[model samples]
Target chain A: MKLAITTSGETVDAALDSRFGRAPKFLIYDVESGAFTLLDNAQNLQAAQGAGVQAAEHVARAGVDAVITGHCGPKAFRVLSAVGIKVYTTDLPTVAAALAAFKAGSLSQAEGADVEGHW
Target chain B: MIIAIASGKGGTGKTTVAVNLALAWGAPVWLLDCDVEEPNAHLFLRADSAQQEIITVPVPQVDMARCDACGECSRFCVYHAIVAPGTKPLVFRELCHSCGGCARVCPRGAITEVARRIGVIETSEVEGVTLVGGHLDVGVAMSPPLIRAVKARIPHDGVALLDAPPGTSCPVITAIRGADAVVLVTEPTPFGLHDLTLAVQMVGALGLPMGVVVNRVGIGDNRVHAFCAAHHIPVLQEIPDDRRIAEAYSQGIPIVEALPEYRALFRQLAESVTALCAARRFVTQGDGHEHRGGGETELRPLNPATGASTTEGANANVRV
Candidate 1:
């Protein structure tokens, strides 16, 4: 399965960014192959408004099956769910740790937005 | 003539000046409240019957059947209002600027324009003065289009007084642009002085003749007066800090109505504005050339750290 993780850096060991919309980078990891690709989020980070929705659009376009992030806002959550992408919240130190938690079934699926829009 | 009353700081009496001026001017006057975010002119004017019309902007709607989503529309939009990730394009109406560039750029003619309501404009007559105001929908960020709609109702022959929103942003620019003259209302406090300078630069950049009305005098130092004096900008009127005015304002009764004595003062203010407009027209005609470049000198950058003026020749040819 293809999964996207909001991270502060490009590597798997990088710390998870708390902000899904303004994260510095996103790592698209193929769980079976253990390979990953980096998606730069600089444009959405500098967006004047609706950064969460725009970032959600970008991640949805990447064909990810699920998203692992620290928090998801209402607009981003709406867009991700509309594309059938499950959103999971995690406070793990690194992307690899979050992935382990996800595989162990410790992470909880977000029933709705975890934060308000523009948060 | 169109006269825009603007202030860089909020609660500096833009509506107070506008409502009283409309009331004092008697007939053949139109009061346009361009502060769509918080329109308060109607609260004072108390119009009998207001007619409201919805204002909308064109947003792109894609025809999925025509398909080919080559992402042309997404690429053409500068505001990222449309995004085509897969074979389908998604449209975000809130971010759309209604430039119609996406619709024109679509190769298959699949993109169509749809109306999205952003706000409404209301027009009514009160005491012989026509009041036109705009109210933007809550959470809607786009206001310039609605402001333009309110401006369209301005009559050519009568005097049009526009109460612009506070601050020197896009909305304020939209309100004061193309006016015959601009009346900048400000207080004497430091914050008021700081913003007044910015407003002056904006009006100067637009090449419009402007005058100052010092509201709530004696509250701060004379720095604002000094600044205007140094720039040769006319101090059109100085309204004292009176408790009765505030008392009347809180009750939604115009000062001219509560204190009939102030009627003559407002009438004099109106006459001075008219004379200023006439003088500006005479100067423009006498020069035999448009004053297109007169305002460029005042557009220089100011040192924000020191709060010092960097502009030179600010008063050259700016007078009416």
Candidate 2:
């Protein structure tokens, strides 16, 4: 099963990133084979302010079963739910711990953040 | 008469027509700038407003003292304005669209609503024109409430020109809801035509009498006129791209003020608008209660053949 993992850095063990466009990278983890590939998100943020949606889209298009992040905005949460991506929130500093929590079905979804209108 | 001036797209000189018309009428006319998000009518009118009022909307204010963080508000909120699943709920003011659904469903009654001031509407008099406009506080998300506040102050007997927001959105809908007529401004560009269709659909849905005012008429294609012809919507006036008009706008003056020769043109536009209002025939709904409160009354059901079979709740007033 593929997983959309939002991270604060290039490595898998870094903190979960919540800020929309500033997150350095996102790791797409393959749980079944324990394989992973990192996709650079710095360039995508330039085109869209809400990188969370783009990150969600990347994993959803890859047929991911879940999303693990520190925080998710209201719009991104809606998009993720529409695509069948189960959202999980965690204090786990690394992507590996997020996958472990997912395997145990112990991951808690983050509180949905508010997003008024787009100015 | 309340006359709303709208443009299908941005930068179509909707404000220009509204300001000029208000000035030319020379009555106690109220100029409502309903484009709250980026209101620019003030830039042209330059009115020194004395009466200013802040506009607010009711939003859910979660009470932390009332006990459990059951997360019901978060789950129920479609926009996710409240998130208090664990501890006290964090209300993100930017994302709250001011829909009162969260407050109504709160079982604990912890979600009492509070008024949040998002913008200010002011009234001023400039050279005999009563100018009313709104300025959205920076970073405010909502605008419809502010538009409503400004419109409520319109003088009933004079020409009320509403400078509506440029779009087919909720704010635009709120601005033009009860207008007697609408003057749609547009240019003759491909983008202009695309957005004009959207505006036309919106106006048709609202069932309002409308006409077009083509600004900068000779600059682009005649596709706008062609579309109007196809739809049987009349083009009431054509404005040329004059450098003199541009100069006047830069100086924050109405065309009627800067160019005395153009006063007659605006007067004619006002006359045409009044004629349109007179030709409308209003059919009141069958609820038996008068809609306009006081007027010569007439009731015409939508489908006379159905008669009593038609479910009529409120009388529909037909005005030509």
Give the top-scoring candidate (DockQ). 1
Write candidate 1's Cα lDDT for B1-320 as tens digits. Answer: 99999998999999999999889996679999999999999999996689989999999999888859688887777676787655467787888989999989998999999999999999998888899999999989878899999999988788999999999888898998778888999999999999999888877766667888899887998999988877767788888888999999999999999998889878988987887777667766886843533345444443221112333334354321
Quote the lDDT for B60 in model 1. 93
> Candidates' TM-scores?
0.88, 0.69
* Residues A1-119, model 1: lDDT tens digits: 99999998878999989889888888999989999999989998888776887788788888899999999997677678767899999888899899999889999999999888677
User: Candidate 1 at residue A96, lDDT?
Assistant: 89
In model 2, which runs have C-alpha deviations exceeding 4 angstroms? A1-119, B86-88, B281-320
Task: Give lDDT: candidate 2, residue B229.
Answer: 78
Best lDDT goes to which candidate?
A: 1
Please provide, for model 2 over A1-119, each residue's C-alpha lDDT reduced to its tens digit, 9 standing for 90 to 100. Answer: 87777776766677666543345677878888888887667764564233444555555556777777766666566556665677777767777777778889888755465433121
Model 2 docking grade: incorrect
What does candidate 1 score on TM?
Answer: 0.88
Counted clashes in each candidate structure = 0, 19
